[model samples]
Target chain A: MSSDAATDIMDGTHSALRTHGYAELTMQDIADEAGLSKAALHYHFDCKHDLLLAFLDRLLARFRERISDVGGDDAADRLLSLVETVLLPPTDGEPHEFRTALLEIEAQAPYDEAYRSRLERFDEVLTEEVRSILEDGVAEGTFCDDVDPAEAASFVVTYVRGARTENVAVGTALGDSLEAFRGYVERALLAPAATSVTDGGDADDGAGDEVDGE
Target chain B: MSSDAATDIMDGTHSALRTHGYAELTMQDIADEAGLSKAALHYHFDCKHDLLLAFLDRLLARFRERISDVGGDDAADRLLSLVETVLLPPTDGEPHEFRTALLEIEAQAPYDEAYRSRLERFDEVLTEEVRSILEDGVAEGTFCDDVDPAEAASFVVTYVRGARTENVAVGTALGDSLEAFRGYVERALLAPAATSVTDGGDADDGAGDEVDGE
Candidate 1:
């Protein structure tokens, strides 16, 4: 099949998934969304599982494209933008519903090798992008010298992933989470005071005075 | 049913879940593990869903008990213990398999009100403990004065949740993540130098000097 044709099928899959989610989706729904016959879809993909895997790959490609074009003033801005791109929901469908469907798909990773691999690719690519930006930030003096790019990138990506799940599972506001993350980046990441990690290995002195609950 | 009997049933559910996972689990498995007939199991819970919900409730209770007992020298240590309690997988059955089943169940939160409620309780309790610890740390001067306990608690909980998901989905090393988190807490939360947040919202000046990628 032509590349454009395949893209169309992938878009169709996205629409169908948004509507029916993973549990109830079918090949027919994908075909109907693509405006192709079921036989036509079969001609391209053997089964729903195969089609879903390909869809994930295409989604990753789209993500890569988006990242390359996400212009920003500094590496810090770019890193945040890269995170927002994945953390926030797309406007195409009900945010909660789409996340629900995505979570359902993600839950299959441990049991599904294809799904696991695709999801890992997504994580790997995002982590790399964040790590690169972090390195840039450190070099430009926008971030602290001691910042470990790869480690921080992993943390950010993992936090973003969990935030999405929180948005769906517990209705935590994504905007609040994003703002919280931004604040963290500002205080903890951007220009942190050079400090050592010496805790003295000593317990607290029980100065427990002036302790008021927030 | 008696409290001890119910506890036994919950224990059975846990074992059954670990052995068979959420997808393949059945009432029969739970009953067998509990050393009761399926009919006896049904006498307490009408169906598998109800029993599973009860199981989640019991898990949270167990977590609370564990948290209460996890004594630490100071609030910071307490906070770390609190986070670690949930971040690390239980030493039961196969860790990956158990996490997979748990992820599958968490994915059902959107469509399953009972699951969502139970899971929310988990988040609420963890966040509360973290916030309480942050407050104590601040009062004791172990943490920064400007640290917003609630906001930071939310971030920490979200990161921990994501870290657990990463552990299951991508096989991320939980130990490495915990160490990284410790680093973050030390640098960001623990007595950070009193500073202002004045970035001026200005774009990059492009000094473009001494730029070395990490």
Candidate 2:
């Protein structure tokens, strides 16, 4: 099958999963949603599990691309941008479909080892990205020397994941909570000199120079 | 049905939900798990939804009781204990079955209005308890006067819920993250005088008197 055809089939599977959930999903439903014959859908994916795996791969790739595109020269800015990308609802104001779908998929993980392993891999990649940022920040003397990069990265990932999960249920913006997290990062993670230079009363003056260097 | 019999039924339902998840759960499975005839199970709860609702009610009650029983004289200690009770895995190292079940139920919330409403009620009750603690702390000058109890309480509840959800998938104890949260509370929420008096090098002397007051 062409890649475009596979994409269309996966998109249909996503819609079906969202509407009917994993347990109730069926091949007929996916085919109807995709506006394709059952044989055409089967040509791309032999079964529901295969289609879901493909969909997950696509989602993870998109996530990696988005994180990479979160552009900023300053390490702190880049970290903050990554946090926003991971946690915030999209600009279109729809309930976060990807996250919602991921939760459903995760529910099946206990029974499906493949799903569980894929999720673990996704988590490791996320934790590594955050750890890399923390390591860079510490090496550059931008973050505190005492901060354990691994633990702090785990903390950030866990907290952001938690916030995203709660937001789905409560329908509330986590903006205030994110602000609180940022404040914690500034106070507890940033080196004193960096904190003073970046967030002090004269931040505008110092920030301009930093931006120019970027 | 006797209250004891009802409790047994709910317990069995909990086990079934944990093992098979909400989508796959059936009344027959719960009946078998409970060692009761199908008719007897039906006598307690007419349908799966009714049984789940009852189970959630029991869970909420137990949560309230646990929070109330968290013995601490100081507001900060009480708050910390409350956080531990809600977020930590059990001492016996069992996976958090109730929270795992909750995640599954929450996934069904979009399609189940009854579950959505019950979860909202649970969230409100939890938020209120946290808010009440913050208010008490502020009145006692233990927490910062500038802290918005409502927003801060919401943040705490949201973060804890998120942590619980993620822990279900990742199999990590939320211990380190909880420590981070406590650190945030001490630094950002406590009044300076209270923080120093409670956590400073001279805390042993000051805390003795506070403990005596209790």
DockQ of each: 0.51, 0.42
**TM-score of model 2 vs. true structure:** 0.83
Docking class of 1: medium
Flag regions of model 1 displaced more than 4 Å: A3-5, A89-94, A192-214, B89-94, B192-214
Lowest summed lDDT window (length 10), candidate 2 chain B: B203-212
Clashing pairs in 1: none
Worst 10 residues of 1 chain A by lDDT: A194-203
Candidate with maximal lDDT: 1
Q: Write the per-residue lDDT of candidate 2 for residues A1-214, one digit (tens) a residue.
A: 7877877787787787666667678999999888899998887788989888887787677777766667555566667777877776345322555456677776667667778777777777778888888898788766777677887787777777767776656555678667766765665576645633235343323433342153
Backbone clashes for every candidate come to 0, 1
Structural similarity to truth (TM-score) of each candidate: 0.85, 0.83
Q: Which ten residues in a row have the lowest lDDT in candidate 1 chain B?
A: B194-203
Could you give the CAPRI-style class of model 2? acceptable
Interface RMSD of 1: 1.0
Position A177, candidate 2: lDDT: 64
The parts of candidate 2 lying over 4 Å away from their true place are A89-94, A138-145, A174-214, B89-94, B136-147, B186-214
